[model samples]
Target: MNMITMGIEEPWFKDPGVADMFGGKADVETIEGTNIVIRIDDEILDLVELTVARFHDDGEWVWDTPDAYGWTRNINGAKEAAMKHGWSEALLRLREVVPSEVVSVLDNIARMAAAAVRN
Candidate 1:
């Protein structure tokens, strides 16, 4: 399958609030700009496992988290996705932790999302 692999945009992009897969408290406010609240329980974990079980469903299996420019084949589509999913806030928080390229991507997407709402 010639699937176009997608790299993670930032370390905190998936769910920054999730400290770990084990029972960990969410990082509600430490994210600074973003107010994203994540509460992962057994059910959420179960669902996540069903999708991918690379580490044998072990939460401790850390991933080689990537730092890339909001990776996506489509830039405008990424912006629209961020807007549709209320991820602009998360992107704001992610911008602070990622590299300059990542920051620029997130900032651009966020600005576009904001402008889209006004139109």
Candidate 2:
């Protein structure tokens, strides 16, 4: 099914209060422009939480380093560690806390990334 179809029916998608929890606060045009919501059934909120943590950890690594190589290596290492250290658990916990509908809205991000790759 299409991203909208999958997400619209989810519990998180309907609630306005929890919209921002899954990165749903962004404008419709931006969200639609990226088409990030490809897999509506996917755990988008969980992924988003993981992404935030990824950036936070990677940023810290970069801040700690001095050279360009440090930027790349540390960022890469942080990502590797994040994924290795239980990305699944992070996402699962995010899902447990955030609403399912918000998660659906967040899944659209995958579509956006896919579109970027194809281009």
Candidate 3:
């Protein structure tokens, strides 16, 4: 299983209010920048990775699971599947701890990454 751990070096994380929002959920390193770590399961991670790789390679966007074997061409559908799998309970917890604007920023970042993989 792979663990997704991200270090947020954004200046906004230094704010006391912002740090407080995370409470005990995230590890606030210091006033310089805070590191927020969100862990997710391997299946979702693998799906996202595969989706991005296919998108970058301009290959068919189909999730070829272990139990399935077929070349089904569905770029939009694949992208949607990738996006849906990318979302998790950790994101919901992140939303609860961070401001709406911060959440929006994170969401946008996630979407951008997912878009890059999808395209």
Candidate 4:
């Protein structure tokens, strides 16, 4: 499985208060702009695992942990997805299974992914 690890060490992005929301070990060194790192690994990473597990059981769990960036990353990704394959029926089905907020972001991400693939 492809494993990706993204981390951010920005002042606002890694704000202690926000970092605490996600849970322990969500903090990175405070800096200016956030940093995101995605890489393939020997095993699936936590983010992918959480998404898959929650998706399978239709669970509702907010990501309290601080990502490299703030909430905007989520929105940006979703929008990118929407610009891609035009949000297919199957993708929508999977997306709908998640919470509305998350779905919104993912819907956009789907478009982004599709567009990236096309390119």
Candidate 5:
């Protein structure tokens, strides 16, 4: 599904609420021209939470860091660490609360990824 199908939007990705949790706010946008919302689903929200955290903490996403090798490494490390936590631990919990819907969403994504790899 596209981003709107998964509940993703510009504002959500650069969330003030999420930033405030980390002691700041964020503002993500499109690369050029008008902005658009892609996914509108639980998975998008989960991913947005991760993204917002990175942007808020880093203070230099695409805007400030054009040649972001460090940003790449940071996200890579974070993705690895989150993976080390496993899907259940990494994805299902929002604010330390586990939700079955999140698990179901992640399971679907895992299956899709596995199938793509197998193919």
Candidate 6:
């Protein structure tokens, strides 16, 4: 489903207090542009880009840094590591506001990004 539809269907967005959580506005368009940065040790990774790339070619991901080479050696392992280490204080706070279905949420966002590119 599209983001607007997802927002409408999701009970969280329907709550009046949801707007206050997002600085008095719960715009789906604004949330659509949200970026999630994942850090693995000293390396920073784009969560959306990684999710999209992972599904694009049988789950293979590449990174530029020499240190990244080791991280990408086992793709699933790297993803698990990222999920474990990437939760920032802001994200932890966001988790309290949003549901815990992070994997599903990231997959949907990645799909939307890919569809946007195609159209």
How does candidate 6 score on lDDT? 0.34
lDDT (C-alpha, whole model) for all candidates: 0.31, 0.33, 0.37, 0.32, 0.36, 0.34
Highest lDDT: give the candidate number: 3
lDDT of 3 by residue, 11-76 (tens): 222322434433333223321222223434322222212121122233443332222222235645
Off by over 4 Å in 2: 1-45, 51-73, 90-119
> What C-alpha lDDT, on a 0 to 100 scale, does residue 89 get in candidate 3?
33
Point out the higher-scoring one by TM-score: 1 or 5: 5
Give the distance in Å from residue 44's predicted Cα in candidate 5 to where it truly belongs. Answer: 14
Worst 10 contiguous positions by lDDT, candidate 1: 45-54
Q: Give the winner by TM-score: 2 or 4.
A: 2
Clashing pairs in 1: none
lDDT of 4 by residue, 1-119 (tens): 22333432232232343333344433233211222222235332222111100111222222322211122234334233322322232234334443554556778899999999999
Better of 3 and 4 by lDDT: 3
TM-score of 5: 0.25
True-vs-predicted CA distance for residue 52, candidate 5, Å: 6.1
| Of candidates 5 and 4, the better by lDDT | 5
Q: lDDT by residue for model 6 over 16-41, one digit each (tens)? A: 32233334223322221112444333
TM-scores, one per candidate: 0.19, 0.23, 0.23, 0.19, 0.25, 0.21
Question: What lDDT does candidate 2 reach at residue 81?
Answer: 42
lDDT per residue as tens, model 1, 1-119: 11121122232333443344323432322211112232222111110110001122332222211121122233244333333344444344344434554556778999999999999
Candidate 2's displacement at residue 15, Å, is: 26
Tell me how many clashing residue pairs each candidate has. Answer: 0, 11, 0, 15, 13, 0
Best by TM-score: 5
Candidate 4: how many backbone clashes? 15
